[model samples]
Target: MREHLEGVRLGGEMEEPRIRRAAPYRRIAELREDEEWVKVMGVVVEKKDSEIVLDDGSGLLTVFSDKEGMFEEIGVGSQIRVFGRPMLSVGKEMKAEIVQKVDGLDFELYWKVMEEVKRLEEEIR
Candidate 1:
């Protein structure tokens, strides 16, 4: 009985460490806009070769990077936090600079959104 109890305690201890590691990312959504730099958790909704589109619940913003190598591991459905100036393009499209992806969480949200968009497009056809 003592051995079983110790095993259960060990399992609980392992889970707590993982939860604590993720706690910092949970606070990403609380960032304020007035701050010079803001960290936001967002899903990568679009990836067009060199460009990436991140959707942080509010809206989608485009990120353009000259270093395409940085984007090799990023997929359409990845979650990322961008650190840079937000600007409006000539076409009034909003975008961010110096974007970085969040690790561990699979880009599942991006895949889900992409599937929905594809379904809608098919219906329109």
Candidate 2:
């Protein structure tokens, strides 16, 4: 009885769960066959009814969405951030879960910040 409550509080509370995190950002060139999820930011190089092609400078990736009109508002030349799972196919492809347009971003500064964040994350690990 007492042993069962050793890690539990008097009010039956337990440790709070860690906050769930979204996918990590990755350059298109860094995507691999084994990658499950990723976040990517790129310019829209092409746009179709259900898919859009993103170019992050390193490479191009195709992002498909099942929702109708997902790519309707997104046009070529627009910068966007995409959260999705990579496709299992041979080519560079992903199934988009969320798409967000990024306006007036400084690419050079963003890259620098992202690099620093990655370095910190690696150090923590």
Candidate 3:
């Protein structure tokens, strides 16, 4: 049986979607067909009727969502986190299942730490 988590929290940290940390973070340029699901954080650069583009300095990725009101809170310059599946066709793109605006996110710092973690993990092997 799972323990009740009614008021329990971690290190007094803000509540966040668990999967946001569970999913591996991938840069816009690193996303490809091999990944079944991914987590990407970037600034919104473009928005079309059913698509939104994100840029993470690595590259640009077009995210398509058919859900109504999906982009309601997302806009240009908004820092957003996305969890989705990527499809590789002529070019790379993603179909997001969850998107949310993130506050107080340090994009550069986060990426830097993640990179170091990846490097250390690879070195362990």
Q: Give the winner by TM-score.
A: 2
- Whole-model Cα lDDT of every candidate shown, in order: 0.55, 0.87, 0.86
lDDT of candidate 3 over 21-116, digit per residue (tens): 366788888887887878999999998778899888899888889898798877789889999998878676899999989866999999999899
Question: Which candidate number would show the highest lDDT if scored against the true structure?
Answer: 2
User: Candidate 2 on 1-125: residue-level lDDT in tens?
Assistant: 88877887566668999775778889888887676778999999998889999998889999999988777778999999998888847689999988999967876688789989999999999
Candidate ranking under TM-score, highest first, comes to 2, 3, 1
Instruction: Give the CA lDDT, 0 to 100, for residue 6 in model 3.
Output: 65
RMSD of each: 13.1, 7.9, 9.1
Q: Rank candidates by lDDT, best first.
A: 2, 3, 1
Estimate the TM-score for candidate 1.
Answer: 0.45
If both were scored by TM-score, which would come out higher, candidate 1 or candidate 3? 3
Candidate 1: list runs displaced more than 4 Å: 1-38, 89-97, 103-125
For candidate 1, lDDT tens digit of each residue in 32-112? 333443334577788877777776665556666666565677897787766643344232132344566676655456547
